[model samples]
Each structure stands twice: as structure tokens, then as C-alpha cells.
Target chain A: MTDVASPHTDPEQKRGLFETLEIDTRLLGMIGAFILICLAFTWYTDGRFLSARNIFNLTIQTVSVAIMATGMVFVIVMRHIDLSVGALLALCSAVMGLLQVRILPQYGIPLGSPLIAPIAMAAGILTGAAVGALNGWLVGYQGVPAFIVTLGGLLIWRNVGWYLTSGQTLGPLDPTFLKFGGSEGTLGVTLSWIIGALAAAAAVWAVWRARQVKERHEFPVKPIGAEVALSVVIAASILGFVYFLNSYLIPDARLKRMFEARGEVMPEGYTEGFGLPISVVVVIVVAIVMTIIALRTRFGRYIFAAGGNPDAAELSGINTRWLTVKVFALMGILCGLSAVIAQARLQNHTNDLGTLDELRVIAAAVIGGTALSGGVGTIYGAILGALIMQSLQSGMAMVGAEAPFQNIVVGVVLALAVWLDIQYRKRTGALK
Target chain B: MTIETKIDPRGTPLVEMRDISISFGGIRAVDHVSIDLFPGEVVGLLGHNGAGKSTLIKCLSGAYHADAGDIFINGEQAVINNPRDARGYNIETIYQTLALADNLDAASNLFLGRELVTPMGFVDDGAMEAETRKIMARLNPNFRKFKVPVAALSGGQRQSVAIARAVYFNARILIMDEPTAALGPHETQMVAELIQELKREGLGIFLIEHDIHAVMKLCDRAVVMKNGARVGTVNVAEVTDDDILGMIILGKKPPQAV
Candidate 1:
């Protein structure tokens, strides 16, 4: 800042060194290819895919996988994985149901009572957090590979969920519980997703602010062009969505009421309000927010630093263990949130709930660009990954593809994503 | 009457490690090594490959805890058990790696873990950039701006950042481990100029180097060590490169070596 001269005699050499080290040029190509694939999917799905309703529907359906994948992205970025999401979700949901069906009844709260459902959801979240803590503590402090610990927890937690409910699906929860996960706002959008989006937006803003600060302070700032471009793309996509959603002739009850107040009859149908499935909004928001945290904060830096070179980070005075523990906890909290959505979507608490969710979530993250060996990922990448999986599944299903065929397609896609990651690593020297 | 401490204000020693000793695996890596550093002066630590110069300096930098001995700051015994402690003592260490993250810029590396955050609770990058500019202006007015990442910085500029990281933290005692190593002649000269600037700031410097020419050219005093033992400390003006080299080879005083 003070002096005009850089210490390096070869400035180009230094820039080239980083260019050869951190990012893969091929990733940009891959992103282009991903966009093409998306366009193809929409094209083949024949207008249904592009329709606001189905796109919204897709968002709702993919919420669980998206949120969990975002969490797993950080875990994987730190060179770890949580195979326990499915089982943990099941176990937590089971715990919530059991507490509602059994304990609330003892307190004179009926099964469908508002208090009962809220308590159950809280219990579910708590259970998930506890399970996550167990994983983090074990991994961070006990020196265990996260893959092994979380996998063990996955099986064990599922067994516990099944056992606690006597292997039965519990249900007919309080109607008000719908507000948490089942209820979309009167505006025709899910409150959960809105809240999730708000949270994510805040995180993104904070990160963006931090980047600006770093730049202004004349710190070793990254190029703002790419970031600004990417941000514009994200903002454009969101704006385009909101704009189109608003443009449609929404049948609002309020508008109807106003018409009726003017002596006109209200229209009949679930039309045109600003409504989204609660689950859809929650997952998208959570995914974006977590991704920002993974990118901007000290916590995020520690994850990548740990992933890139643990010894160096340690020497730099970072508490790597705490970072590990915190990441696991974060994942746990997300899984719990996903549990409520999953349970609400089914409108029941089943012992089988959240089963195989880990597979879908981890697969999505890996496909999005997160490496199992650690230190390379983005939350947005995870979103793209989740969308890719969901699109493939929906497209194949639409074409009458069997479950086996869908699974095989997913497997091939997963393999290709990993291959791309390897090629990226080779180009960047991020991998041996 | 208050003592007011009869210490030379400007000529004060920035860092002093007395009887420093460290052991690893029952082997004494640094044995009873002592060094004194004065502001505006360059002190050289010369030794063989395993001569304990680095280990001794690491103790002061809080990279390694001394099994025995204490480090003093401004004539006060300071306990530097960790790097943070060294940082608190305003003591900075620059290894050959430069410890600069290539992804980060000079300001980011200078601030590193202790970033200048905004009031809103994020890193105030603009302020950091400004601060980096100010520091660079003082150190090298000709230093380039927009070295987006330290990796993009030249060897001299990267060294400047590493040095700036120390100075930014208000370090009075600065340790350089082969600061000019692996640099071209011009790059080395650039570093030499930066060192001079640091000295002008009234900083006490300890340069751990293998080059006797650099030691002969820059140091005010030269301390020689061998096999975890101090050979002798001599005024550089009174010692020759041959004298120091002989001390490094034979582990004795310059006079004895001569």
C-alpha cells in the first residue's frame, strides 16, 4: 500500500503461481456444460419444467436434499462427510413424533394440539443437534475420520428411531404444526422458504460486505469482476423468478375479499398469490446462507485452510479441532430442519422417514464440486448439484424411466462430477 | 522519587532472550543461548546447518517454548509461551516460507488472523487496503499496489508483506530467517533496503542467515553458534566473514578461529 514496488521481481510469476494453484479453468467449462444440461432438461421436459408451478414444485421437492447437501458441502470441504443425515433425520423426526404422541398426551395436550407439534419439532431439532455434536466431538477431539463416525451414527441413529417408535409410523399431528413446515403464507408461498431465503440473503450480504472491506483496506483482495458477475447472475435469476411469479394473475383471497366488499364474488381456486412451498424456500435459503458462511467468515476460511493444508493452518494459529466440531454441529442443525420438512411433506412421522437421504444429499454435494478429500467447494455449487440430481430424476421419471434406471443415471452423473473435480485439481495443482 | 527506569529511550534493546534453552526428544536443540537486540541495529545469528540459530530464534517468536530461559521486552521479562504471546510482545518471525497465503493480498497477509474488522462485524477491507498502502509507503514508497495476492508479489514485495505483518502488529523485535534466500541480487538488495527502513523505525532485528556476505554487510553485531552452543558474540565491525565462517566451522571465538 505504501510503497509502489512489489517484493517479487517477477510479478507475473507470482500471479501465475496462484492461477496454477487455486482455481481450475476447466471448472468454468464444466459450469457452462452444466448450464447446457439444465437448458436441455427444461427443453425436453417440454414447458412443464419451465412453468412457474413445476419449478416451484421442484423447489419444494428438493428442499430436504438441498439443505442437507449444503451442510455436507462444508463437511466435504473440510475433507469429511456425514453419511448420517438420513438416519439422523429419521431419528429426530421419530423422537419428535414420540414426544408428541406420548409425552404431550401425559400433559393433557392432544395429539393435534398446537403446543404438542411445536414441542415435537423443537425436540426433533434438539435431537439432531445433539447427534451432530456427538459426531463433531468424536471426530474433532477423538481423532476419528468423520466418514466413519457419521456413518456409524447414521446406522445407529436409524435403529434408535425405529426402536423408539416400536417400528411404527406415528401421526395425525396438530394442524398448527403445519405452519412450521407444511404451511405456506397466505401469499401463496411457503413461510419456511421465505425465512430461509431471508437468512441466506443476509449471509450473502455479510460476505459481500466483508469482501468489500478486505478490498478497501487494501488487503490481498481477490478480483471483484468474477464475483460481481456471479452475484449478478444469482440476483438476476432470483429477480427473474420473483418478477415472473408476480406477473402471473394470482387469485388472492384478499383481492377477492376486496371485490366482495365491492359486492363482487371471489374467484374459486389456489391461484396467483405470492406462494411457494415452505420447504422449497427453507432449503434454498439455508443452502445459500451456509455457503456464504463457508466462504466469508473465519469459520469458512478455517474449513478451506484445513482442507488445503492442516499443518499450515495449525501453525497459523487456527483451532482446527473447534472448526471441525462446529461444522458437524452446523450440519446437524440443518439435518434437523430438513427432518421437519420431510415429516410435514408426508404429513406423518414414519420410522422410514429420511432413509437414503444421506445418499442423495452427499451425492448432490459431490456432484456440485465438493471433494471427499477436502478443501474445494461452494454452496452454490451444491445447489447446482442438487438441482442436477432432481432434474435428472424428474426428467427420467417423466419419460417413464424406472427407479433402477434413474439410480443408474444418477450414479453415472455422480462419477462424471468426480472425474471433473479430478481434472479441475490437475489443472489447478490442488490435487496430486 | 520514581526511578523512571534509566534506559536509553531510542537506543533501547527491543528484545533480549537470556539463557534460552529448548529440548526436543531429550536432545537440547538450543542450549543456554542468549542474545540482545537494540533498536536501529541488525544482529546476525550465524551457525552450521543444525547450529541452533533457528531453534533459539523460534523460542523468542513463541514457535517453541524454551525448556529453560526467559525472554525480556524493554528490559522486562516476558513469558512468550505461544505465537500469540510473541505477537503480544510485538515480536514477529518471518520464515523462509514467508508464511504468506498466496491467495491473500499484502494487506491480508499483514493483518492475517488479526484483521481490521468493520464496525458492522466484517473485515473492513477498505481500511485494510488503506493501512497497507500507508505501511508500504513508509517501507518502500515505490512498492506496487494491486498485488491482488501475495503470490503475485515479487520476492522483495512478498518479503515486504511478511515484514509488514510484523510491523503492523507493532512488533519491536523482528526475526528474519534467511529473508533474502533464493532471491536474485536485485531482489536481495530490495530486501536489504526494506531492512534498513525497518531499522529506521527503531526496530530491533535478528537476521538468521547462512550468507556471511550478507552478515558482513548488514549486521551491527554477529553472534555465532554451533551444535546447540554459542561460540561468541562479536561486533560485526571487528569481525570478518572469514572470522565468522571459521567460528561456524570450529565453534569458537573469531580470535581463537583466526
Candidate 2:
């Protein structure tokens, strides 16, 4: 028995490259596909597609759907689909827009007041949470199927947003709120580098700390060479991403306009890049937090356990019904956050804001490797999934493809991705 | 193997389900059944497929709420509304289906709802795996695939996981439903040995079984049910195997028991 178990804990055993690197093969495959798509687009556009400016634009464009896609992973991992996120986003956007434009002003708070943004954002998110709780109540406690509940929510919330705005677009929102829209605000080159450095340090420290913990527990630790290589790779990726973003110099015209607005003379050859958009930063922060929640927390464990075998989870004394409510509520809150990014990006709230976003978000989660059958998903996978979906759309549009043709391609790609995932799972014997 | 004849049935039972009845829709799945288990004793529940053995045990395990009657633990009336409540009373159940999450690894499944966490509220996966390794080393020494999901394991391995979960939590009153059904002969023998070890530790066990030979070997008392009602419970020391078989198949109490 000891001999049989030795290979697992022994570092001397022959191992594959993936095993040595400790990287998920599925994630590696997705990254490869993303690079391939980027290269193909770059070739088709004659070197314009991979430009830093376009990459910056791509990151911001992916933010709204990516934020909601993280939540969708949890929902889908529990074998439940949330079709109301896009519609819910519109409703939240409408509420925030109306509050910023009309209600807050009537309450003696001006549009430019700092309180206006937070107040309106809170109200919008609260509204989302409430509606989400209602949806969850219907599904978990009332025993209504999640599909039917969220499907009805789709129609109801979209119209509710329309009724709120009376078919008129509302905007010219608070300036502070608009910063979350991307390109409107940035971390600046220096601050971006500072953050990037800090992130790199954190990544390396995390690896070292994990190894220390494993050693303290007397568990098998990875080889030192492998650990160092992983840390170097992680740190390099962070610093490299910061450098790429920093290379996209701001347009001189926009720089001059900024100097004039600040009532200062523009210096000769004074140039700076938009190192990282605030919206992209939001996505990054969200990705990190959601990953921690998915991997570290007890609530996260229950979500996976319940997803894996609901009966077993129940038998293990998990409150599965309440867990359902919490998951949907979390999804609703994410929709509200996405609404903030979407409305800010557009600089206004249109009645049809976030239209068709639900399909895109779901596709992103599935393509990122979240199994619809439940009990399997990762937060990073969903975000990457969003990036892939956005890249395909942006890449095709750059190449002058027709909108209808682009949709056809996206639809076919979604099917192919799932089919490929199934094949991979079958090959690995992860699926029966 | 020396069987310890130390059971004293006259004392306060470790667990008592008095006149427990539960119905599904219009059907009485478990009708007016009463059974008791003493400390350090094994009570074997024997019945046909629909004879309500599982249903009756489920009530005690808090998987189902009985329509009528009460449960007493250590001579105190107990209120068990759910599995959590049952666990609070130091009651653990190894379900018939093995009730394991197929997608999670063995360690994750072992610590499913009751994870060992670090001081900062994060799940301590290393600690959990270490503890699981120790338990598996004792329970099933051949279990090496602790990193893969339980779905990849063979039936006997999965069964061991279920058994280990029930035993790890210091259960005073344990309920095992067809625990050895999926095991090979060696694993079954291992379970029988484990049962003996647990019994000597003063844990009362309710063993739901279809195998009469297992009952004769492991049980201090055999309780037979027919059509959701108890036929009789007799001391294994006195009742012949044929008498117990008649009670199971014919739903008739033996003359001696009467």
C-alpha cells in the first residue's frame, strides 16, 4: 500500500509537462485558442488588430459581460441558468440614470455632487438584489423551476426599464460615475506600474507561502525549480501586461484638451499612456475576489458540493434551498455592477441597454469550460470566456464581416467549443 | 472471533423510535413501527424491498419527518427536523446509495459540509487532505486515488469513503443502510471487523440488512418488518435462523418470540 501511494507523493516519478507545471490543461487550451484568434485577426487586419489601443479597447469591451459571467459560472455550476441578467442590467441602469438625473436633484443633491453616484449606485444594486431574492424565492422555496422564473424575469425587467425611462434615453450622468465606463478614467502609467509591481510581488509570495504551508502540514511539496519557474512566469505575465497597456500613448489632441480643461499650458512633447482603464481594473478586482470566493470560502465549497450531488449535500446537512437564494442574489448583484460599467461606458442609459448580453455572457461561461451539467467551473475560466467572445466579435467586425455573418460564426463557434470540451472530457475520462 | 455478550437490553435504550409513522401522498410507507437500540449493540433491520425498512430508518436519520410518534435519545425526547438536527444529537447515517458528490475528490467529499478551515475562515485544503490520508490509511489502506473525484473510484472505494465519513465524526448512534452491499468479500470482512471495533467502543448501531447471515453474525437483536409494520424483534442468541427467515418471508412471529 505504501508503495502504491508513493508515486503520488514522490517527486522522482516521471511526470508530464502539464503535471510538472501544475497547470490545468483546459485553461492552457483556452489560452492557446485566444492567442490563435488574436494572431489570425492581426494577420487579417495587416498588423492593426493587435495594436495596444485595440487591446485596451478589447479589455474595456469585455468588462461588463465578463463581470456578470463570473456570477453566471456559479449559477451554471449549480445547474441553474440566469436569463434575466441582461434585462436586469437594463433595469438597474434605468434606475441609476433616473436617480442621478431626476430623483437626486429633486432631493436637493445636485448631479455633480459626490453623494449622487454612490447613492444611485446603491439603489440600483439594492433593486437588483431584491429582484434576485424574489427570483430565488420562487425557485428555491416556492419550488418553481429556475428557467421559468428567470425567463419571466427577462420579459418583465426589460419592460420595467422601458416604462421607467418612458422610451427616452437618460444620461449625461455624473462625471465620477462615468469614470467606470473605461477610457474616461485611467490609473495612469506610474500608478499602473506600481500596482503591477505589487501584484507581481503578491503572486510570488503566494507561491512561496503555499509551499511553506504544504511543508508545515507534512504534505508533499513541489520541486523548488518548478515553484520558482511558476512564480517567475506569473510575475512576468503581470509586468508584461502592464508594459503592453503603457505602450498605448494617449492621442496628442486628447492630451492638449485635458491640459486646457485644467487651465494649464501643455508642456512640449509631454506624453502619457492610459495604462489601465478603471473599468478593466474593476474586472481585475472582481476576478480576484470571485476566485477567492470560489476556492477558499465555506460558501463556495457548499456551492460545488451541492452542485455535484444535491442529495449528498443535503444529507451532509447543507441548507441547499438557502444556498440557491444566495447564489441568485449574488448573480443579481453582479448584474447591477455590470450595469454601472455599461451605462457609464455609453454615457447614458438607453431603454435597450444590455440587449442580447445574456446570451453572450452564457456563451462566455460555457466556452470558458463551465459544465452546464453542474459541479464544475472556475472564475478565471468565465472571464477568459468573456474575453474570447468579445475578441471574436471585435475581430470579425474589424475585418468588415457582416453583422449577421458574425452572429452565425459566433453561434457555430459556441457549438464547436462545447463539442470540443466534451471530447476533451471524454478523452481524459473525466466524464462517463 | 469472540462475540461480546455484554448487551443489557433492560436499561435505557441509546435510541428509541416509538410508534413512528410516515406517509407519502396517500400511501403509508412506514406504518406504526417501533424499534429501540441499546448502547454498544447492533440492531439488524430486515424486511422485503417495500417493507419500509429504509423509510423507517430515514425518519430516525431526519431525512424524512415522521407523520406521528417521537424519538428519544438517551431517554430524552429528541426533536429532529432535518439532517442537521440529527447530527446535533451525535447521530450519523451512512446512506444506502453512499451519498457522495461524484465531482469532488475523496478528501473534499469526506469534508463536504463540515470542512476544516484555517483561522482566517479559509478552507484548509492541506489539513483536510492530511486528515483524510490518516483516516483512509486506517479504513482502506489501499485507497491511493485521493486526488481524483469519487466518480472515478470503484464501488468498494466509494463505499469506504461513505463509511469513513460516518465514522470520522464521532457518532454515538450510527445508522448504516446496506453499507456492505457494494463491497467485495474482503471489504465486507473489513466492515464486519470495523463494526466489531465500533461496537466495543460503546457506539450503538442500527444495521439495515437483507442478508440474514450478516445479521446472525453481527447483530445482538434482529428486528423484522413486513409491509411497513414490525413483525417481531428477537434476541439472536435464542432465535434460530429459520425462525427469523419465517418472520421475514411469512410476516409471522415465531412461537418463542410470541
Computed on C-alphas against the true complex, the DockQ of each candidate is: 0.19, 0.48
Q: Which ranges of candidate 2 are over 4 A from the true structure?
A: A1-15, B1-10
Q: Write down the DockQ of candidate 2.
A: 0.48
Lowest-lDDT window of 10 residues in candidate 2 chain B?
A: B1-10
TM-score of 2: 0.96
Name the top TM-score candidate: 2
**Any runs in candidate 1 off by more than 4 Å, and if so which?**
A1-34, A179-236, A243-274, A291-296, A305-312, A371-375, A402-405, A418-432, B1-12, B133-157, B254-258
Least lDDT summed over 10 consecutive residues: which range in candidate 1 chain A?
A183-192
Can you give the TM-score per candidate against the true fold? Answer: 0.80, 0.96
User: lDDT scores for all predictions?
Assistant: 0.74, 0.89
